[model samples]
Target: MSDSRGAAMSDGRTATKGLAFHRLSAPSVLALARGEGGGAAVEELLTAERSRRLLLVRALADSLGEGDPPHPAGTAPMAHRAAWTLLARTQQRAPRVFENILMSPQTGMWLSLALRRLRGATAYEDAPLWVVAGHLSALAAAVGARAGLDFSLTVPVRHGRVPLPTLGCAVFADAAEPWGTAQVDAREGRLRITAGRETVTAGPEWSRSAPGWHAVRRLELEPTGPGKVLLLDELDPYRTFPHPSPPRLLSADEARTWQELLTGAWEILRRDEPQSTEAMRVGLMSLAPTPARERYRPHSVTAGDAFGGVMASRPDDVAQLAATLVHEFQHTKLGGLIHLGPLSEPSAPPGAPEQLFYAPWRDDPRPLGGLLQGIYAFAGVARFWSVHRHAADAAYAPMAHFEFALWRAQVSSTVDLVHRHDRLTALGRRLLGTLRERCEEWMAEPVPPAELALAQEVAADHRARWRAHHLRPPAAAVQDAVEAWRRGDARPPAALAAPPELAPVADTRYLDTAAVLARYRLGAPAADPSDIEGVTAADLLLARGDLSGAREAFVTQLAGKETASDAWAGLGRALAGATEHRDASRLLRHHPERARAVQSALEHATGRGADPVELATWLGLGPGETDLD
Candidate 1:
C-alpha cells in the first residue's frame, strides 16, 4: 500500500472541484421522467449521486469539531483522516475501485445517517461517536482490499460483526460486549481481522468457510448470463434507511428460493422489458431481504440516501419479483434526480400547512412530494404490466391485465392532480407533463372490456373507501341533513353542496377489501366460496360480478347491528353496477361520509339501523323537490 502520509498530501479541493455543480441535460431529464430512459441516463444519475456522496463525506469530516465530544480513543478523527487518505490513494491508483465503494448504497446511507447525527438532526442514542465514525474505516478496508493495496486499520464491530461496506462482513464468535473494535489487515487482496486473541483470515474468494467470515452472497441469472449481479446483503447494518438494523440473514433454503426467483425474474425482464433491464443493470445494485409480508403482496422501500439499494420482502412468485425490481428501481432513479434539484418547494407558503393529497397506493394521506413519488413508481409499474400482460401465461394473464389497467388509471388521475398543484417547480411540471403524455398513450391501449370495468370499479371503490375513512362532511351539512330526515322532507339540504374536510379516522382496517377481493378473484377464480381474510361474502360476490347478490348481502349486513365502513362502500359499488338506485349509488360512491353521518344520526335517534339504500336515496334527492330546503 502507498504511504498514508504521502496519499494525504494531494489537495482534496482539486479532486472534488466541480462535483457540486453537476447537472443533467434536459433531454436526459425528460427521458427519465417518461420512465423510458436507457442506461446512459441512469448512469448520469448514478454519477451525480456519487458526487453527492463524496461531497457529503467531506462535509461530515469537516463538521466533526462542532458536535459531540470526541471519542475517548480519538477514533472518529483518526478514521475520518484515514478514510480520506485511502480514498485519495485509491482514486489515483484505482479510480474504478474508488468509484465503486464511494457510490455503494451503504456508503451513502452511512454518510447520511452520520451527517444527520453530527448536525443534531437526530439524537445519537446507543451509537456513540466512535461507532458512527467506524464506517469510514470500514469503507477504507473495502477500498484497500478491492484495490489490492496492503493496509491495516481498526474498524468497529457491532454485534460481533465487521462490515466492509460493499464486500462482506467478518463475523466473530459471540462476546459479552455488544460493541467492540477489531483490527483489519489487508494484503495482496486477502484480508484478516483480529479481535482480542482470535484472528480470522480470508483469501481472495472471501471464503464463507473461513472461521468467522460471512460473504455477501451474489445472485445472478446464470454463471455467464448478461443479467446484472446483485449482492444479497444480510450482514451490513446500514443496509436499510434511518438507522442500523440488525442483520436478519436468510436461512439456507430461503436463500436458495431467492436465487431461483431472481433467475426467473431476470429472464422475464430481459425478455420483456429491455429498457427497464438496462436501467436496472446500471442503477440497481443490491437487495436486502426483509421478512415476508402478505401473500401475493410484497412490500418494498428505497431510501433517498441509498440510491441503488432495495429493501424488500420475499415475493410470492417470479412475476412479483420482476415487478418489484422494476418498481423499486423507478424510486431509485427518481430519488437520484431529486438529489440533483428540487422538484417541489421545500415548504408551504409561510403560515398555512402543506396540503395533503390522495395517493391511491397508500393507506394514509400524502404530501405533494410523496404523491409525486407514488405517481412515478406506479407509472413504471403500470408500464411493466402493460408489456408483461401479453407475455404472461394464460393463468396469470388476467392478473396482469388487472394490474396494468388499475395502475394506468391511478397514475393518470394522480398525474392530473399533481399537474394542477400550486407548489410544483418548473422541473416538476415538465416531469409530470412527460409522465402525463406517457399515461395518455397507455390509456389508448386496448384492455379487455371486463378487465377495464373491473379496474375502474376497483379504483372507484378505493376512492370511496378513502373518502369514507379520511374525509368528513361539513358539520352544518350533516346537521341539516339529519334535521331534514327527521322532518320527513323529500329534498336534501343546501349545505351538502359544501365539500368535505380532511379529518382522518384512525381505524383503517378492512378499507381495502375491494382490492383484496379483486386479487383473490383474479388469482383464484375457480376457488371455493370460503371466507377470505379481511374480505366479506358481499365483497366476494361484488368482486365475482354478482351485483344483485352482493347488494342483497350488503343490505343484510347494513341492516345488522354492526356494519363496517366497507359495507357502505360495497353497497355503493353494488348500486352502481345495478340498473336501479342511480342517485343512491352516486351519493354513496361520491359522498359516503354524508350517508354515513345521516345513517349514524338516524341509528342513534331510533336505536336501530335504517335501510341503507333507502337512506342513500333520501340523502341523494335533488334540492327543492318538496321545498324541504
Candidate 2:
C-alpha cells in the first residue's frame, strides 16, 4: 500500500495529531475493540450524552475549518485550501454528538439519529450532519483507496444543513485506477473497491436532509433489501474526476434528456473538435468546488449562468436538454479562451451583481470587461437554441418562452458587450433579422414537414444575435429590431429568419407542475394555485389565511379535484369555520382522506360548538373513541 503518512498534511496539520482521522492510541483502540467504549460510546455520542461532546464537536468544527481530517480515512490531494476553510465553519455548526459517533464507532448510527432529528427539527442546524459527512467521507475514502492507501478510516459526520457539511484537509497520492475495483466492509457502509478508489454509500436509507429552497434530495443509488445497500453503482469516469456530479433530482424524462444531451455533445466533440472533450472535462475537473457551484446544480449557489451539469427548476425536455448541452458544451470549450485575459477587467456591469458577469472575456487583460464576455457568450448560446427551427413550433414554446424570458431580461448586459465587440454584435443582428424574416414567411404558410427546418433557422438566428451582441460595433439595427420585437412587434423579420408557423409552443401543464414541485423543494414561492392551469391551488391559500381569495380560487381550481386527499383536506378545514352546519357537515363527509383527518375533525368540532355525536356521525368516526393533537 502506498503510504499516505504525510499526504494528510496538505495545509500543515498531521494525520496522527489533532485531526479527526489519525490512528487512535493503543489504549483507545483497545477500549474500542473491548466494547468498553465502542458500542456504548457510539450510542452515547449518537444520542447527545453531554457537553463534552459539544466541545469535541466545536473542536471538530474548528479543525474542519482548519482543514483537518476526521481520522486516517482521507488522504486525497486537495488542490486548494478552500475546502479546509469551508469545512472548519461548517463543523462549528454541526451537532457535536454526531461528530463523536463518527469518531467513536466509525459506523453510521449517526444516520439514524439524523433521520430522527430531521423528522422532529424545523431548523437546518437541527438536521443531522454526519450523514452528509459520511457520504463525503465515502468519497474521500474511496479516492484514497484508489490511490493504494488501504488505511482503515472512521465514518464521516453527515451534514446537509442550511449551514452545510464540514470537510477535512487530507491529500492522497496514486489517484488513477482500474475500471472494476475491489471492495471492503466499513463501519459506515460498503466500500466499493476499485483500483485507487473506495465508494461508501448507505443508499437512500440515510438521505435525511430536508428538501429546501432550490435543492432536492435525489436518490442516485438505488436501495437494496431491508439491510440498506446501494445497487447498480457503476463508477463513471466523470465521478472520479474532480468535477462534481452536482446533485440532480431529475425525473425519468429529464434523466433521459441529460443522457441524450451528453451523447450529442460527445458527438459534437468527436466530430468538430477531437480535443475539446478532454480539455473541457479536464478544465471542469480542475475547477475549484466553490466556483463549481456556479457551474451546475450546486447546493449553495445563488445565481449565475445555468451551464455545465447544473439543472434548473424549469422543465427540461429532450429538446431543451439537447439545446442546453450544445450551448453549455460550447461555453465549456470556449470558457478557456473567454475567461482568460485581454478583455478581463475589474468592473461589473451597472445592474449586474457579480463581477464575473461583466468581464469582457477570459483572455481580456482588463478584469471587468473580460468576465462579462464569458457571460455574454453563454447567454448567446442559450439564446440561439431558443429560436432553433426544430424548436419553433408551439409544441416546444415553453422552452422558447423560458429562453426568451432570460434573453429579454439579460439584454441590458448586451450593451456592455456591444461597447466591446461592435462588429460581431452587428453580424449577429443581421443574422437575427434574417431569422425573424424566415419565421414570418413560414408562418404565412405553416406546414408540419418544415418544422425542423424552422427550428434550425431559429437556432442559427439565436446564435447570430448573441454572437453579434458580443462583436465589436454590434449591429445597431438588430438591437433596435430586438427591442421593437420585445414591444410586441408582429414583424417576424426582427426575431426570425423566415415566416413562422403560428402554433402553440408547448403544453406546459406537466412541466409547470414539476416546476411547482421543484419550487417547493427549493423553498420558493409557488405560482398562485388559481394561476396554475391544471392543478388546484385553492386549499393552499385557505391554509395560509387568505380565506376570501382561497374560497374563490378553490371553487375554480378544485372543481374537478374533489377526490384529491389534499383537496378534500383543504375543503374540510375551510368548511369547519363556516356558520352553516349543513355545508360544513357535507364537506366533512368526504370519506376519510386518511382515517385520521376524519377523527381529528370530529374532536375539533366538539371543542368548537358541534355536539360530539353529531360531529362524529358527520365525520364517520366510530362513537367509541377520538384522537387529537
Candidate 3:
C-alpha cells in the first residue's frame, strides 16, 4: 500500500483513468471530503492527482454547477452540458467548488471507470479509487477547475453490448496465451479468438447465451437470436497473477449442465423479465464455474461489472439456477445505477451517526447503503418467485410463496428507511419510490396462509438471530440497568444506552434451500436440519423460540462448535427469557438485535410449548421435532 501521505505512489503499472492506483492519505481524503483544513492539503492533492484530477473537475463542475442535479445517476458522466440540462434541480443545495463533493453520480462514474483502469490489481485497497476521486474532486474545488476547460494531472495513470455482432474469422495471439496479444476478425461473419491451444469460434452466428435488470439504462442487443457467451474465463494471465481466485474451466458434464441451466433461465426471463434477459446477454460476457467444494452445492456471484460471472455447481433444478442468476444481475444493475446516481448516503457527514444496523440476510451489520443493496436484490428475488411459484411443484410452490412475501416485506422496510433520508438525490428518491411501489405490488399477491406463516417465521427468526448476533446496548447504560435489576426494580428504564461493541460475524453459513427443495421434490424426508453457522442455523433454532434450547444450541453448538459470536447471541436470548435477568440483560444489551428478535418472536410465535418436532414441522425443517435450547 502507498503511504498516501506524501508522494503519489506508483508501481510502474497504469489504469484507464489518468491517475494511477493512488490512494490519497486517509486523513487527506477525509479532510478534503469534509472541506476541512485549507489550502496546504488541497495543494498536496493537486500535486499528486495533478491533471488526472481535471476529469473529475470537469465532470463535477458541469453536473453540479452550484446545484444538485435532479437525476444524479441518470445524468451520465458529463459536467458542462449535463450542468445546463440539470439546472432545474441544482438551483438549490447545489455544491459550490470545494464543498462536500460526496456521492456525486458523475464523480462516481469517473471513479469507477478510472478504478477499472488498474489491470490485474493485486492489492485494490492500497489506493481506493473512491477516496482518490473524493480527494481529486476536492482539489478541483480548491483549484477552481470548471467545465469545458482544459486541465491536466501530473500523476500518470494508465488505462460492451450484449450479443455483439457475430462474424467468422480465425484469431491468433503472438504470445503463448491470448491475453494482450489476442485479436479477432470476422471477414465473412464467423468469429474466433485463440487462447493458448484453444480457440472459441462462432460460425457466422455467435448465438449461444448464458442466462441471466432495472431503469438500468436498458441496452438493446442486436436480435442475434439468443444470449452471448465469453469463451475465455482467464482474461488476464492464468498463473494467479491478479484476481483473488482464478477461474476453473467446467468439466464436460458441468458444461452440459450449465448450458441447460442457461436455457432454463432464458425461458423464465423471456416470460416475465424481458429486460433482464437482454441485460444478461448484453452485459455479462464471462461464465466460470466456482471452485470445487467438499460438499455438493450451487453458488453464483458477480463483481459489479456486467462482464465477469461465476457459478458453483450444477443445480438439481433450473429454478435454483435462475434465482441466483437474477439476484447477482440485480446487484450489477444497482452498481450501474449507483454510478449514475446516489441511492443512499454514500458517506458520513461529520456529526451524523455512522451507525451500522442489523440486516436479516447478513451475519454482520451493514451500513445503510449495504442494507439497501441487499434488500433491493432480494426484492428482485421476491419478484422472481412470484412467477416461479406457479411453475414449481406442490411441495416447492409454498417455499417460493414464502420467499416472495418475506423479501418483499424486507425490501419495503429497507426502502422506507432509505426514503426517510433527506440527503437522497431526486433520482435516488425516484428509484427508491419505484422499488417501494414494486415491493408493495408483489407483497399483496396471494399465498397460502400456512406458507405465508412459514415465510414470516423464517424472516422473523433470521432477524432475531441477526439482532442477537449484532445489536448491543451501551456499556454505561447496561451497567445502570444491571444495577437496577440487582436492586430488584420492577421498572424498565425509560431509555437505555447504546449497544456494546462486539466483533462482527465474518463469514456466515449460507442456506441450502436447494437441498431442501431437492428432498421435497423427491418425496424423501429431509435429513436433520444441521445448525448452520451465521444467520441460517440460528434462524432454524430461533424460529421455534426454544429459548433454552437455542441457548444450548449456541453455547454448545450440539452439532459442532460454531462461532463465539453465535454462542453469545444464543446465550443472550436464553438468558433474557429466564429469571436470571442480569446475564440476559447484559447479553441483550450486547445484542440489541437479538433482544428485539426475541421480543418479536414471542409476540408473533404461535402455540406455546409446541413440541420441537411439531415446531420443526411447521418450519419445514423436519418431520421430527427438536427442542430449542
lDDT by residue for model 3 (276-383), tens: 555555444444445433222455555442222343345546676677767766665555444433565556677775657666566577776787678767766777
Per-candidate TM vs. native? 0.90, 0.30, 0.54
lDDT of 2 by residue, 1-629 (tens): 11123211022445366543222334432332221222222232222222222343344334345443232233321311322332333344443423322332111222223233334433223212333333334433433322333334333221211111111111112334211112233243322222234332321222332223121222221123122111111111111112223223345564444344444434443343333333333222111111122111222111111112222222223344334433444343232222111222323355554332222111112233333333434444433443442345565444444444333233333444444443233323332343334333333433343333333323322222222222221233334333433354433122222122221212211212222332232233343343443345663465355656655563343333232323333344444445553333232333222222322332344332223223323433322113220
Error of 2 at 159 (Å): 5.2
The candidate 3 region of ten consecutive residues with least summed lDDT is 156-165
| Model 2: CA > 4 A from native | 1-139, 147-149, 159-314, 326-343, 347-374, 379-629
Query: Compared with the true structure, what per-residue lDDT tens digits does model 1 show for residues 1-629?
Result: 22111111121333454423456766677788787677888988876676677678668767764553456465556665676687778889998998887787888888888887777677533667668866778888888888898888878888788888777777778545787778888888789898877787876886364667777888876566755788888878888765678677789999999999888998899888888888888888888998887665578988999988998899878998899988888888888888866678866567777788888888788888998889989999999999999999999999899999999999999998879677888778888998999999999999998788789988888888888778887877877887788788887787875778998766575555677667767886576634545678888788777889999998998888776776788888788845468778877887787778778777887787668998888877755322321
CA lDDT of each candidate? 0.79, 0.31, 0.43
Candidate 3, lDDT over the whole model: 0.43
TM-score between model 2 and native: 0.30
**Number of clashes recorded per candidate:** 0, 126, 47
Candidate 1 minimal-lDDT segment of 10 residues: 2-11
Error of 1 at 288 (Å): 1.0
Best by TM-score: 1
